[model samples]
Target: MKILLRPVGLTFFFLATHLLQSQASAPGGSNLLFYGVAALALIIFFFIVVSVADNFMVIESKQMGIKDSSTMGLFPNIREFFRGKKPGYLDTAHVYTLTKGYDIPMAGAPQDVIREPNVTRFAVTPPDYFGLRPIPKMLVEEGDVVKAGDPLFFDKNMPRIKFVAPVSGEVIGINRGLKRSISEVVILADKEQVSRTYTLPGREASREELVEFLLESGVWPAIRQRPYNRVADPDIEPRDIFVSTFDTAPLAPDLKLALRGRMDVFQAGIDVLRRLTPGLVYLGLDGRGEKDSPYSVTRGVEKRYFRGAHPAGNVGTQIHHIHPCGRGENTVWTLGVEDVLLFGELFQNGRFDTSRLVALSGDSFSEPCYVRTYAGANIGELIAGENVREHSRIISGDVLSGTKKSTDNYLSYFDNQITAIEEGDHAEVFGWLIPNSAKASVSPTVPVLSNDLHLTTRTNGEKRAFVVNNDYEQVLPMDIYMTQLMKSIIVNDLESMEGLGIYELVPEDVALCEFACVSKQPLQQLLRQGHDTMIAQG
Candidate 1:
């Protein structure tokens, strides 16, 4: 029966094609019988193709251990570019360090610990602390002793939002910042066991109900929308959603570790996001995740393999390839994999319960591993530096993209990694043109006699204008023109930036461009500037 059907299927497909072609060639006196037969054949052909594809479909599962060399790992790739080239500037690159007063004076003795003005009353007044898309109703007042993960406030506009407590302390403080007119709800945690479970709304949640749930629960504040980079408006429907698993910047977090035990939460978050958007959730997995994720089209999720150097793993590149945000028609909302858990927590309970796993790495560190910490939590408690290093620069994120954090400073909204590299006082000889083998870190174009990956993270060459043209293309796996888009952003060309798709990029995405940059320009600053300009204009 199967063999008989095979010939019938093929014959019908060809017949349909011929009929359509004949109609195109001879429009007048078209046969009604031919039209009916062609329609049937076309439908049958579609089913046959679908059936075969379903049977032969491959399912890729994301596993923990899979190590592959970088695109530069291929020898011919490196040699092909360096063929018959005298290794001088590429070998001895001249870069200018653009220090924009980020350099802070070293703390004299014990640095004063200043409580974050925002987190002061966060526990008692959770909703007041976080900015929701629409404002929420204040639940509790001052001096209310709240337990960890307990609801603080709910969004009045969409009441599902439930802001929760970060620590188990007391409600000791409450005050307002000068401008922004946002309330400051302080919560000191109780340190006692608080019941933290709620019945999750199953797959049957209606769009209106889900929006209400998020607002009342307080987690709605976490879902920020783009165009203006403001909190997402529940009233305004979005076109698609984006989530970046790993940050590929200089001192970015090890997202693989961050998501290690939280796979369930991550999946839960993805599941929730799938509800809000009409299109597919394009998972921008680095080459690693693309080969591993296991999801079919029925799941409404599509996976694309992003293989690049630094910014290659960025969400901007992912958006540019999978679902390019259009001008005034399509809007893409991007979130870090770490924060997605907060969305998942919304359904489980009215609490903000995700403490991210971040890493602190640079030339100044003797150890670099994942640290379990919460958003807006003080970093001084987790970092230990008195042993081997002194006078080192402590960066809040990756060295290239991160901000200069005070020793007394708590981590801010955009930090995933804390890098500590030494601000060495070693002076060099005519550093711009010298073979910086001992001090410089170059890519395929090594300095005169320097090719070592196992060296300290000190800048060997003088910071000139950014110039090294390493293998950015080899690592960047996006379809859009990266260099051109970057140029448009620099010039503040809003129309061009939008045409080139600026909505896909966050500051951390451009860190790799800074790391491999020969001109040594701060690419993050440029990206942030563009983001700010766009938001302001909007």
Candidate 2:
């Protein structure tokens, strides 16, 4: 099956390319030699394109409630989609809680949880992703006794930021959350006042000093940079830095909530990050309805408003949009809003704090809210109660891009929620052909069904080969040509891939493209291939 399927898939791609070229108008600057080969390539390409287009099954977005004309671009053969009967769910996984964590379809089993040093406690509250202007304040003031993981305060912002206690002890002096009128700080002290303190391995401090300190202290693993999503190397000086104040995915956790009461740690993290990169550290925030931010302290940090979904706030996307990477350029590092404080505290005192805020959502989940969890900790404890409804699918992270990890699986570098939805079992006689009105999203491009605000926990359609040209670009905010880049990488055309800005991409950027692909190509694999290929060449 693998051998037969692989060749067929490749044939489809080659044919698809020819089909696109034929449809597109050629540039006037083209020479005779180029045209000769292009024409010859077209001849052989036509047969393969026609064969694949004829044999393959495609579902039209129009019938599925996709009204946009532009969506046809994602799928090569949009006209044939509405031809026959509609199809049902292609792949389905039950959302369950095992010893590992939440069980998802795509992500498989979760990796073992790794506990870094100096973790203090955990705390959280309602509305993990809230709008700006109303950052939550800590419930406990200076010198107040609190549990290891307790609710610090409710965010004053729209969605509400729930501050969690880092350790069980008396409250310490608030940091910089306080302002002329608004304040948003929560400080926790260790009960013994021992674990609360952080110290570098050596007394002397310089840019290299802190780097060496973090590397030796085991807190170095806490700093994760992008492109490869690995721990930032202390030895290397990063070209750029990125920080996001909020997430724009469907159910992303609000940084304001996660960062509440930890403004000092956040400030400290920023200081450390700046030392590693002489270039600017771009901080992304939501511009829509944003008021004054209480946690922002980095003096020269270039702040930008992310106005779209998913990748809009992705550090990789921000870097690609702002300062694109060129050949031979070093890495660009990024930090999560909450992790910034953790790093700060790690150097300020020697304590390691790994607690984080996790959001629980999905159609099958009875309770959809944010829970406090320790970094790299097992997810089973965070997502509680009867998660599975008869047979449901639980995915860690956003539905479109997240992996279907097991309940026992540990969370990854930049993830916050476990979304559970019912495994769609119902079959339709003409599901694909019919104008689906039962609140199904063919892609973000469809109007009647695309924005159907009534998305439920039920798997409306089966996860077949990703069909439908959803507005993946709307969610994926990047400078690279996602579609073209994927093709170049697949064909191993290094020069074409580089020309299309392959260096500025990461696997997560293609997650939306994968979800919105009509061909259901594994976009993540394609991105991974590009990254691996580029790295290998380097």
Taking every candidate in turn, the Cα RMSD to the unseen true structure, in Å, is 16.2, 17.8
Cα RMSD (Å) between model 1 and the true structure?
A: 16.2
Q: Give model 1's TM-score versus the native structure.
A: 0.62
TM-score to true structure, per model? 0.62, 0.60
Give the range where candidate 1 is weakest over 10 consecutive residues by summed lDDT: 95-104
Q: After superposing candidate 1 on the true structure, give the runs of residues whose Cα lies further than 4 Å from its correct spot.
A: 1-144, 147-164, 171-202, 227-230, 289-300, 348-351, 385-388, 424-426, 438-443, 447-492, 516-520
- Candidate 1 overall lDDT versus native: 0.54
lDDT of 2 by residue, 344-385 (tens): 767665575666776666656654666665543345545644
Tens digits of per-residue lDDT for model 1 on 1-538?
1233456667877877776776766656268547756687668867677545433331111121122111112121332354343223222221111111111111111111211222322222232122343334656667777665566665564455466665555655554434533244555444343535555567898977777766655556567665534457677677888776655554455566555555666777878888887766766654433233222111345655543345655666666545566435577666777667787665544455755655656545555555555654555555743332677777676655566665545565446666676665656567648554444343535543422122334455445653435333444444445566777887788888877756766555555555556665666667667777876786
